[model samples]
Target: MVLRAVAVSRTQEDGGRSELLRGTGVGPVGGLAASGLVLGMQCALLGVGAGTGLLALEGARPADALAYGAAVCGTCALLAAATMLLAQLTTDATGARGAGLAALGLLYAGHGVWAAERWSRAGAWSPFALRGAIDPGGADDWCPLLVAGAALLVLLAVAAAAARGRDLGVGLIRFGLRHRRPLRAGGPVTLALRLSRMQLLAWAVATAAVAGVLTAMGENMVELARRGAVEGGVLGSLLGGSDPGAGLLDYIGVLAGALACAQAVVLVGRFAAEERSELVEAERGTGSGSARLLSAWCLVSLLAAALTLGAAALVSGLVGAALLDTTAGDALRLVAGQWPSAAASAGVTALLGGLWPQARWLAWAPLLGRVA
Candidate 1:
């Protein structure tokens, strides 16, 4: 949302690409710092709330809960800041989001490995070791907090230094194929797809990576289930079915569907942004009407959601078959079974885009409400 807001602001200014680069102080450096701080603080508060609430329910001492909350908040602060820096350093919105999400996944995975191995000597070095420090029934320790705080300072310094050398709109890494053919005329749908193709690809890759990881760990997950580790829990209720082998596959499908729905909402919001910025308007002035352009954007947003989600489903199916002893056909069928829910979420977003383009963000309310 922050990145989208930034992108929208950038589009509001009347300037060439190079001019925006020259506005780096306000555009990249300042925005990065401010957004990072805000997101970091929010994450910290959220972690604190969740951690304290759960600990309180478990009859832990208030002092201990507060201490754990502090540790979680500190770790979250560093993570949020680091992710924001990574996002700012990326060239496009999609890359920014993807990199940040991947970094988050890596941090958690690293912490999981560090904990599961029962290795304490290297705990301080893991990016998310703070989580382990706040373990229930453990000694109250501040070492992880100290380490995270110090690391955050160093990371902030490095991120600021890195920002100094980068052009405002360019990323550290850039790759694209030059067009060899003459441009052809197209409707707003074509234009919207072109603009969003990179983001869609990034979303697909992230989804596939997550699904692949889950699929590869299917055996362990099944074993855990069989041992009654997750039996009758939320996981068991959501993923468990007649065939234990298919439980993990079903879980993946549901998760992928939710992600696809969120992506659809984001895509629609992007369409609204472009329309409000007059990018779509300019195209409409060229032998098109507002209604026609809007219809095109709606179609394009739907298509983008479908294509990206389809890619995720396909990859998940193939990966599950290869790594989890599941048939590719079954995996595909599982993903297919969940498509209508995603389509419903996208439909709500599209309705908002058509009726209240400037207020399409309200479309998020449904998803949040559903989750709550």
Candidate 2:
């Protein structure tokens, strides 16, 4: 849902048309609301359809499936409204999207905690309360829909008001233009990193927050360890074999590795976006050389992937050391052990993106299997 909203927002804000709109928009607030409506409607339909179809396939009753779909649709529209507000808060679409991604990760962690700690019976005001929006197994209780619907309305209202007050093509909170000294990037690699600073910051913060949430659930993980699903593997051993509270760490570590690889795949695609936007062609015309420009992103993608896992390992390791009664080294090892996988995924994506750009999505095949 976050991705869908981000994609739609970016499409609506394509660089050139935005400048034109700035001069000509008759009613910025109405236009903003209209665009947000379009985003919400599209996301709502996709969410409902996908949720219903998936639930039906699981043999859920028609009433239950519809209920789940409605919950999903409400959440999707809420996220779209959120993205609209975020887009105004941050100066760039990518930053807004990155912030949205961060929020999504935090919510996912919250959902995990909600389930692990069994907070459903708690009062509506309990912080861990989650509705059927994320945890379908808890769908029998639908009281959360009112909260979600209220949030959606509030977000849309705030977004429209903010739109009315700000000039088009700029954020509500503008960064200072003054600088003490000239800022310069040494090379294409440095430039690429500079441009992606916001995204990297978002990923790091979100990963740490998630790790903290997992650490806080350490006591519950002891009960989870009884399942023994995380036992008996070379990698599993590094995660503390059969230790109390270790099974959940090991399992989530494995999933986090797949996420790291997914990040690599996304980073490699940045070059493709640049190419499609003619940025690469223009840079080549400036004598930057096509090879140098593309190669910069290739190296950046590999480094970014490594940086992600490194950050995850560091945070999760701290969580283990502080709360889980386990050695930090073991937890760090489990989380960071997937560097090779991330590097390989980067190579595959960069290769396919450079060669058969039209079929670059094929690069995602390995990660798909890993995730499944």
lDDT of each: 0.64, 0.68
* lDDT (Cα, tens digit) per residue for candidate 1, span 80-154: 557546754676555665566666555554454455555555345655777667563477777767878888878
Candidate 1 Cα misplacement greater than 4 A, ranges: 1-31, 102-129, 172-185, 227-240, 322-325, 369-372
For candidate 2, give the lDDT of residue 201: 65
The reply for model 2, stretches above 4 Å from the true place, is: 11-14, 19-38, 49-59, 110-143, 223-246, 275-282, 356-372
Which structure among the candidates has the greatest lDDT? 2
Q: Write the per-residue lDDT of candidate 2 for residues 209-234, one digit (tens) a residue.
A: 77667766665445444455445554
Using alpha carbons, what is the TM-score of model 2? 0.78
> Per-candidate TM vs. native?
0.78, 0.78
